[model samples]
Target: MRCKSLDFIFDYFQQIPTMELEEITFSGWTAIEEKNLHAGEKPKDEKVYTMYHGTFLKYVQHIITSGFQRSRDGMLGSGVYVSRNIDKAKCYPLNADKKEAVVLKLKVRVGKVKKIDIDNHPLQKSWHQNGYDSCWVPPNCGFTAIKSGREEDCVWDPARIVVVDVACCLDDKTRWDLRKQIRGMNNHGAKDGCSQCHQNTSNTGSHPIQSCWTCTKQICPFQKKHVCNK
Candidate 1:
């Protein structure tokens, strides 16, 4: 059978008895910050920013490529995109240069994830949103910690986590289609106010295929009255 979107793949995997998948749900925030640069003799503030739609695609690619890792000091961990509605997404530095910044909801699944504690020996206290805790997860591992009495308990919920593994889940065609859809969305030229129908043209200024119309229809349910230009 053919799968059209990542959501379909996620649903299909959820029902497999032998696969033994565990779902992890969370939200992640990223921002397109404007930096003042001092270049050459003439130093001027350069506006460096990315489109919200493009950033969203990159965020998804990061999750697919890097997998998820445990957060440390409330920073530097991979996350996935989970929300179907772009409007409800979260973004950091709320006051970004462009209003197009966004936050993404992520739903991820892994066969297993190992949780460990680093509060031994001299007893170092680790800080997290929950509180002072020493729980840490290894690279390529997913974990969540809850305080229990005097100590924090940690365990390996699963053996490992893998994304887009052809031997296990997702065929080549489906993966290709997924990547193409993301790239097409990133390259689409309708960055201004939303239009009823978006004309997706190629870099060479030619209509390759009516791919954007189909993409907008299938992927952009959040868009208001947006259609693909045939």
Candidate 2:
């Protein structure tokens, strides 16, 4: 992707450990046992239920890499994934804008945070490095959902009906062009086959699909585009 960029979270992937990834939802690995029932729920000796952790929430399988996808306006995508080399996750304090509305507690005025909008991951807008969309997520659409209370209900929509702005320079064509480029790189091995499967273990974990780090200036139809001060 291309654009004029100014500011970006520089220490890419610092908050995360880079490692090999795996598919946690494969059924052969998970087994149903009578003792596996939910709290206070009884288990029939012959009854079996698939395990929930490590993928496969209910019957639908889950992606285990690079995280989710998002639109420029904040709409999220269908799947939430993680990387192969992960053990745990870390959470931050809350932003004033997120304190009440968002469930993911975050720190104040820190990094460029955004909800991946995919699968309602908190800290979607995160301070840590790689806290954007997974390799599959876009740049302009940089909001993070932080929680998963009513995912099917929430959407990645521009907050309000937009009116054309006059000051911006990049037009629809450029924006579309940039987005297309970024998405196309999804399968391109970022560095060797290491990027073969970029995943996020935590739902709130970010999997930013980066464009040219140089293109920091993100233009939106809603506002006048300003030159990003690099």
lDDT of 1 by residue, 1-230 (tens): 66579778899899978856697532222333344222111111222211111123334455333333432322212222121122322333234433333232221222122233332312222222233222222322222331211112121111122222211112456445555644444344333311322332221133322223333333232232433343
Model 1 TM: 0.20
Error of 1 at 56 (Å): 7.3
Candidate with maximal lDDT: 1
**Model 1: residues >4 Å from true position, as ranges?**
1-60, 75-93, 98-100, 108-230
Best-matching candidate per TM-score: 1
Candidate 2 C-alpha lDDT tens digits along 1-230? 64334224434446567788885431111232343333223222223222111221111111112222323333333222221111111111123221111111111111122333344455433312344322223222332442422211111211111111111112455434433433443334222222313211133233343332344443322121233344
Native-to-model Cα distance after best TM-score fit, residue 132 in candidate 2, in Å: 18
What C-alpha lDDT, on a 0 to 100 scale, does residue 184 get in candidate 2? 42
Question: For each candidate, how many residue pairs have backbone atoms clashing (under 3 Å)?
Answer: 6, 44
